[model samples]
Target chain A: MIRFEGITKRYDQQTVISDISFEIEKGELVVIIGSSGCGKTTLLKIVNRLIRPTSGRVYINGADTAAQDEIELRRNIGYVIQQTGLFPHMTVRENIEIIPRLKRVNRADVEARSVELMRMVGLDPAQFLDRYPSQLSGGQQQRVGVARAFACDPEVILMDEPFSALDPLTRVQLQDELADLQARVRKTIVFVTHDMDEAVKIADRICLIHEGGVVQYDTVEAVMKYPANEFVADFIGRNRIWSSPAFIRARDIMIQTPVCASADTTVMRCIERMRTRKVDSLLITGENMRMLGIISAREMQTCEDRGVPVSRVMRRQFEKVSPDENIVEVLQIVNRGGLSAVPVLDEAGTVVGLITRSSLLTTLSRPYLDETEAATS
Target chain B: MNLFTFLVQSAGEIATRLFQHLQLTLLSIFIATALGVPLGVLISYRRRMKKPVMGVANVVQAIPSIALLGFLIPILGIGEKPAVFMVVVYSLLPIIKNTVTGLSGINAETLEAAKGIGMTRIQVLTKVKLPLALPVIMAGVRISAVTSVGLVTLAAFIGANGLGYLIYSGIRTLNDYQILAGAVPACLLALLMDFLFSLVEKMVTPACFKQN
Candidate 1:
């Protein structure tokens, strides 16, 4: 855990950070979100004593960081920055193993740790271990940066827009990987990024700063549902928030236990399920209860007339979404494909629920409705 | 007599002059690198001192090589020492200027990363800054080597031994073969040293620095 008390950083006549104070709990991923020059980077540097605050104290694990030797303090704290900051002279293995080597860990143990760390970050140890930073792509260099941070096994890690330099696809991929990696091996991470969307994806708590001050710092759910003021609402883009719900998942609003039948079922059975559910289509569940295809009543009628199984008539190319995905993506799929609905599958590939177009419209209009009602009062 | 016959007959004298030329150039360059590189690295770190440091180097470079040797002769007395001393003064400009430029040219991002990852100031300089700056610094050294070889030919003025002695004596005696004996080898020596230093520069420079 880390705590900042009355931290104000002034550079000559201009103040970089103005009396900001906050606490990050253990195993929490706190994102410092702001536009560039909002002092997010300056704030991160203050944590590791890279920048000394003009006033106030920073405590890491309940010890005043100012009292500690800067190098000794930084040695136990992982610091990653934008541009991947990889030592160009060092190979991937050497870059990852640098901290351990600095700590004077045995060479064999360091090599062993390097292999493990590379695997943990989804890099192939055999192929990339001996390669230079220039040899790898931008994303690979940042992954190596992450591995280097974890090499020392520091209690806390600070990342300053680690993914900004990467392309969009690589950025998204690395974000998902980092989220999954953090879930498995939770460290108290303080991430700084100028992007609001990235913060929403990765942060447990978002600390939105503006002009060297904290605008709002709270759980992502709270920040979305209750933005505290007009500034917070405007800063997070009011239109986007109102239109696209935050902290929403497919499973949260999906109609549970959608009408379904086995893929091997006859057209007669598919018709019965569709009639009972008062729907036009029947979700055909295949092996392991996964949604294999959709059998429309029209298709089922054709199968019935032809005296064949529903599997022979069902549409096998229907799109499905994971349970944890946001409703924005679900609506996009529905709108783009002109589909009435899409199945929501859980991690096991089981059809947990169905996302209908009607369902999305109802959910999307509630915020505006509430605003209208609040205005009347 | 032909140029070959002249060289063959006076081969002993030519060989001695070659050794002396090598000795004068090499000693001057050795001292220049030893003193210049550190001073260059120092000036790089101290922003306030850069103008004054570079200003001194520029003035030294502006003095003609013969003039430098002549100026040192009065203070240090005419000999190999005065000859070596002035070459060092003349060569210091390139080595120091390049050293300063090389260190400054390193990516600021790389330096920041070095510090962020808990590198001590000394370690950052030695491990990151210097290795990254190696090619540029070696470039400076190469410049120093080539110029030193050319300037050592003028050492003949200060009673120092070199192939220039043959050229000076040949001019006095109006002997064409002797003039070629001194003139040809001095030009060849400069080329040879340039080639060799280029090899060294390649050896010391990391492949990463070469690309950018």
Candidate 2:
């Protein structure tokens, strides 16, 4: 267990992290989320003895970290940073072998352990072992960072926004991979991220830090369901509206059976399908049932040749949003991009449904209108 | 001028003279590195001594090589002692500066990571800090070496042998080729030392730092 007892870090007269106290249980993934300069990183550094607290004690396992040799204390903890901090010159194998080498482990053991760590982090040893850090992508670099942290086989790992540098898709993928690695390895991890969604997604216990001290530290379900104060409520930000659409799948949002037309179908026939269904557009599918285009009412009037194939007259370019995307994200995309409509695509890139501007507007406006109506009533 | 006969007569004398100078310069550099590296490490380890120790090195550097050699001649007398002493003094700045810079410049995170893994102070210094600092220290050694080669040539005035003898002999005889022979080899020696140490620096440096 790692315990922070009355940890108060001050620079001159101003206090950065004040009287922060918490105990992280063994093998638990505790995530700390806060805005920049909230002292989350400072707190992690203090725990690892990188920075000493002005007044407090960090107890690792049972011994006070401050009293012990700082260097020796640090060797017992694994640290991962947002930049990944992989030594640029060293190969993946060499980077992983650093700690082991420092420990004066046998050469054979270091090599074997390096291979094991590479495998554990999901990088094939034979392929990536000799490759330098610069050659790896951001996500791959982070994985190497994780591998390096675990190189010494320390029981506690401190991750400071390790995945923040990655793209959203890659971030989520890595998060899941990390979760799996954590479960398998069962190392006690203190993960720091400003992104609350990531904390909720991966944290065994989410510690919400505001103004240096932890405002709330609890299970994800509790934090999401019952925030401690207005600050937490605001920080968590009306996650209901943000998270509501995540429950939705592409099939649910999509037109179950779209008014589809073949490439050979005349533009007039496609228009007839739109008219019959009272839909604004009819999807154009190819021989392989791939979504080729959408024949809309606008296209019918614009096309000079009404008898032309629907594929020829239909608008091929359109915006798209995944149904699983948060309503907040969808609204942002619609408003920011000035998109009139977006096609919701499935995993196969097949157009499942159309998300129009009106639908998004309605979705966004519904809560405010309902609140206003309730207040009036 | 009978330059051919002059060259033939001077060749054997110059070769033996050059060998002696080269040997002295090389020996002095080897001793300086052996002593300077440890002093640098000691200075780096102790925060209080850093400024003072570096200040001493700076003072040594400020003393002109020729002046220092002349000053040392009074104490040690004209011979290898004064020459070697002067070379050692001249070489200290680069070796000491590089050692301190190289050791200090090691990534704080990497060091922290080393300590986090429970490495003792000696372990960190030997396993992490020393290896990481190798390239920077080698760079310093290279500088010291080249400087020593050039400075050692001045030692001929103090009765130390080597290429400096050619320049000294040329001055007495008014022989230009003798001067050229000494001057060219000395320049070449400096260049060669720099080139060799550069290769050593590259080899010792972790591949990550090479690009930058």
Index of the highest-DockQ prediction: 1
Q: TM-score, each model?
A: 0.79, 0.73
Predicted candidate 2 versus true structure: per-residue lDDT over B70-157, tens digit per residue:
8887799998898998899778888988999989987776676556555678877886789889988998999999888888888988
List, residue by residue over A1-377, the lDDT tens digit for candidate 1: 89989999999999989999999999999999988888999999999988889999999999999999888888899888875488898789878887678779999989998999999999999999998888889999999999998988888999989999999999989998999988988999999998877887788999999999998999986787678898888777754455446467787779897888888887877787788879987788888788788877776665535446778888988888998888778878888999888899887878999888777888777778877987899
Question: If you assessed candidate 1 against the hidden native complex, which CAPRI class would it receive?
Answer: acceptable
Q: How many Å off is the CA of A215 in candidate 1?
A: 1.2
lDDT digits (tens) for residues A1-377 of candidate 2? 99989999999998899999999999999998899999998998888877789999989888888788766666668888854366665688877887777668899988988889888888899999998887888988889889888888899999989999899999999999998888888989999999987887788998889898999999775676578999988898754434635433333344446567788899888778778888786677776556777667886878888887777777777656675775556667777867666667766667667677666566557657876887899
The models' CA-based lDDT, in order, is 0.86, 0.81
TM-score of chain B of 2: 0.92
DockQ of each model vs. true complex: 0.40, 0.23
Question: Candidate 2, which CAPRI tier?
Answer: incorrect
Task: Please report the TM-score between candidate 1 and the true structure.
Answer: 0.79
Q: What is the lDDT of residue B57 in candidate 1?
A: 86
Best by lDDT: 1
